[model samples]
Target: MYAAFRDTVSMREVFDSCSGVTDVVSWNTVLGGYVKCGDIGNARMMFEEMPQRNGVSWSAMVGAYAGSGELDVAREMLDEMPAVGRNIVTWNSMITGFARHGLLPLARKMFDEMPVRNLVSWNTMIRGYAVNGEMDGARKLFDVMPEKDVISWTCMISGYAQAGRYTETLELFREMQSESSARPNEVTMVSVLSACAHLTALEEGRWAHTYIDKHKMVLDNDFNLGAALVDMYAKCGKTDMAVKIFHSLDQKNVSAWNALITGLAVNGDVQDCIDVFEQMKRSGEKPNDVTFVGVLTACAHSGLVDEGRRCFQSMSSSNCGVQPEAKHYGCMVDMLGRAGLLEEAEELIRSMPMAPDVMILGALLGACRMHKRFDVAERVQSEIIGLNTRQAGCHVLISDVYAAAGKWGEALDARRVLQKCTIRKLPGSSSSMR
Candidate 1:
């Protein structure tokens, strides 16, 4: 739209043409256009110059700032508005702005201060809590709401999805249908499908498919929901079903492609994962960082070291700007380490642009355990444990190394510290696993 007028007409010229229109609707449309075109300066200018500002205008400007990732400015706009006759739209905009931006405390404050709370206001706060992993807060809000709708139910389902709480999502989704004005919508099904996918609840996922088909809601613009369905199936380790869905998708996006590729990778179907990547590129779907990670992880699991190395390198200087962070480095190192190429993995760590973190060291430690390299294991263990937010499980790793090498006294010494300090092992650590 901007391209149509950029050469002959200035934005101001086009915007001013609406001046004689004389309605909040016209002004709001112009404001939204400015935001969409990324002209924040002019948007703010037109907003401040408006003679009559309605709740829609205030909400539009607030949304513009929030949409552009300017939470502070949005909050300021909210604060400057007169507290009289402020409609639900204004309050909901402010709540949603802060919530989307991950400003939970501020969003909470806004919700508490709202004089006449409505469904949107409650829904926004609930969505915020869900996004932030404050499920209890969301639940608390859900239990206390004077009114609820399908969106509110969907919000709860999505919160459960965020926590990988598949069962809870299904439970609440059922309850939503049984009670309230909340009939499940496309968004609600998407949440349920995602949970189904994540948990490999194929039966459940299939059930959602039936529901969407029954409702005739599987239109092409619903691609966001479709992408999620593909992701869920893939992550549930169901590559064949995932591929079937991808084939059915009319306009397959990068996300849809990534989902299928990731599913193959996660399931140790390396050749198919590579095939999908090549296919996506040929079809002009640009791979994002996550796409690369999924492919690399596939290569790692299947011992395609060369492909893994190439993928990691490609993510960096190859125009992706992903620049191989610690997780990528860790994945590559783990691949090599699992292959018993400990020295090569160590060399990769040394050559890393960023310092290796606990994950990297832990990978090396696992490799040491595989090949019984106690001496190297001790050093790697210490390095990993030091990086722990708490004590981690380093002491146990060191003790295990000593035991592996038959150094009884040192092993005993390590255990003594555990008895003395009463350190509980971190759940995901090797020390706890062993």
Candidate 2:
């Protein structure tokens, strides 16, 4: 009971009181309690003082050492263990340690040498490969696994989603549905919803939502899953459905709020996006970088110059304390440029703590074209050239700005420079369903 509660102090006191009556099990229990509490030194002392040890005792020490990242000592302990004490648990501890520390080769070596492997052993290996961005390695192992659990499927799906292979993520989910009995859990649905949002596969997203409801996966209870659903609907241009899901959630975390705000902003519902941000603040959920991005985006879309400036100022440490990142600055620049405040936009770029990226400059150049600000456009073109950016849009914008001002020679010069730079614009494409 003491061990279960992690009451190491009480367990140690009781063990010392009944020293003569204590068995190996008692000692192992105390050792495990210390290990669980992360007191490796005390655990080691407990191990050394043990009158007799068993497989559990040895495995505990090996696992503790491996977990603490002392792999060398863990190996030494494993080597010293009698054949009877060196069990699968002990071997797995080493593999888990190596895999967690990004030592995939060593983990595979240990895995290949294990005399016998369990489901956990396979899952750990696959998870290691997936997390390390080696999806091919993970997939190869996942395909041959004797049996797959929910965790096994979730790891592969999550890996594909994280790696931006959204189409494959959805494909794997479909395969899992038909081929595996393990029902998709909250985690599985989160990854699936993310894939659907990226691909704008509204039908698949709606199907996943239905599956969640059928399985009694309460959206109100699971904030992450709720947020994903909100995000999926919002991305697919179903703002009303997204709003419905967002309101249905009883527990509104920062993520859920971000999804709603960003979704509304993307859909061009500027007032609703701003209102949601205000509601988020009133609810005492601190706005994160993402939340502000959405708020600024809405402001940009509608030319809310004064509101955007105020929001940008609030991001300082004295206010909401979300230090404005490049993206925030980009939104501000875009907002100001759209309002025909080119000088103020350029000033903000210059005031940035870090070097301005190409996107920020591109916004100013585009603004220059709209306002016929040929002088500022020329200055921005020089900066773009200095950065040696390969973004074809910026060069094209420079030529357009010159052409708009009736400066034909300058426009021709801009095109000649673009040709000399050997930049090729990528063809745009769209995805559709039959």
Give all candidate RMSDs, comma-separated. Answer: 4.1, 3.8
Clashes of 2: 0
Please, what are the lDDT tens digits per residue for candidate 1 over residues 282-365? 897778878888887888788888888788777755456576778788888888887788888888888988878766776777
- TM-score per prediction, in order, is 0.82, 0.88
Worst 10 residues of 2 by lDDT: 425-434
Estimate the TM-score for candidate 2. 0.88
**What is the clash count for each candidate, in the order shown?**
1, 0
Q: lDDT for every model?
A: 0.78, 0.90
Candidate 1 at residue 286, lDDT? 74
Query: Residue 73 lDDT in model 1?
Result: 87
Candidate 2 root-mean-square deviation in Å: 3.8
